[model samples]
Target: MDWNDRFAASGPGEPGPPSVLVGREDLVPTTGRALDVACGRGTVAVWLAQRGLVVDALDAAPAGLALGRAAADAAAVTVHWIEADLDEGLPVTGGYDVVVCQRFRDPALYPALAGVLAPGGLLVVTVLSVVGDAGGRFRAEPGELRGAFADLDVLVDEEGGGEAHLVARLD
Candidate 1:
């Protein structure tokens, strides 16, 4: 189904922060410009905003953006909701202290994601992977994240159970 229809069909709920970042708050700077790529329903965006970061949440689906807006309002936080197709490329460029792309995999955009970060900025990414599971067209091969982000100072790189996650900082 299309993202707009899929998001519209989903019910409202507090989706909260990304699992990789839940208890690792100290790894991220509390105050800085942050971007949440493919930020469905704005869960992480609002969470980051509440933590004092100026957050920009991007998603292609208007329905998702609407739900995210409502959720942010209910949480008493503010986030800039951007509507753009990520396949075309990142809509904004540079100066972001934190860039998060969770549960969204697009190898073509990996460079853009890294480029958007400021020096010393942090990058958090999670994607489906083939490790310990049946390989699929959508899943990353083993060591994909590690190799793709090798230029950065990797703080966390893990792959197992059909998932791959990376947290790195640019020098």
Candidate 2:
């Protein structure tokens, strides 16, 4: 995915935080380094920065990165926006205190996501699901989130309303 193309195509004021992540403060770390995979306009990334975590926000879109940089600057926090093709996999070099992957589904990257968490780090993810909607290849099935993150200390695992969310802490 060319992030620049997507950003160029966007017609909006600014992107807001993903709805699924709202009211989920417990799933985020209050300090330490964080990573936002496939960070599209950076709403979540900026939110994390506001929460006091230094963030490395990755996206394929240049325009989105620009928005994220602006948001970080306005928030008086630092966020490193890296333009990356998620298809090549997450470019996360250092383990993070918190890792957030929202609205981007890739079963192949599941293990990689789990691998990048520090021992006590948090992993919060939301992906399209087939729970209440017609089944599709990209949608997660019932128990997918729990089954995938079974080793973690799961705080919440909800699969319904066409979405699956998992908030877990690495042990």
Candidate 3:
């Protein structure tokens, strides 16, 4: 999917915030650096900023980053927005206290995702799943999230109803 186009097509939603990766707050650090991968419109990034974490958010879409910047300004928080394609892989520096990737699936980047975490950092991810629906290429198979992030201490893991969510802490 071309996230850039999707974001370009979206009009800004209500000024209020929404979390792309719902729940899993207990796993997130109250204060520290955070990263939001595929951060369309910067909802999660701005939210983390409001939670007092310095944030670095990345997406291939410039339009999305622009909206994210507006949201961060409205929230009176600062977030660094990077425009880049994830297919090239996650940016190589700056470890994060929290890393979030929601509703964007690219299994090829799983290892890089895990490596981006700082020690004791939290990883929250959600993706389309095939557990409760007919299988498809984009839908994660049952246990896929668990296996992909097996190195972490999975705080919450769920797969069903064509969705998968995982919250884990890096060792």
Number of the predicted model whose lDDT against the real structure is largest? 1
Better-scoring candidate (TM-score), 1 or 3: 1
For model 3 the local lDDT of residue 104 reads 86
Query: Considering summed lDDT, which 10 consecutive residues are worst modelled in model 1?
Result: 11-20
RMSD, candidate 3, Å = 2.3
Instruction: Give me candidate 1's TM-score against the actual structure.
Output: 0.95
The collision pairs in model 3 are none
Give the deviation of candidate 1 from the true structure as CA RMSD. 1.1
The digit string of per-residue lDDT tens for model 2 on 32-65 reads 9989998888888888888888889998777888
Worst 10 residues of 2 by lDDT: 11-20
Residues 15-52, model 1: lDDT tens digits: 46677777888888888899999998788888889888
Off by over 4 Å in 2: 1-21
Q: Residue 42's C-alpha lDDT in candidate 2?
A: 88
lDDT per residue for candidate 3 within 58-168, as digits (tens), equals 988888898888888887889999988899998857478988898889999998888989999888888999988888888898899999999899988888778898888
The per-residue C-alpha lDDT of model 3 at residue 1 equals 48
Error of 3 at 95 (Å): 2.1
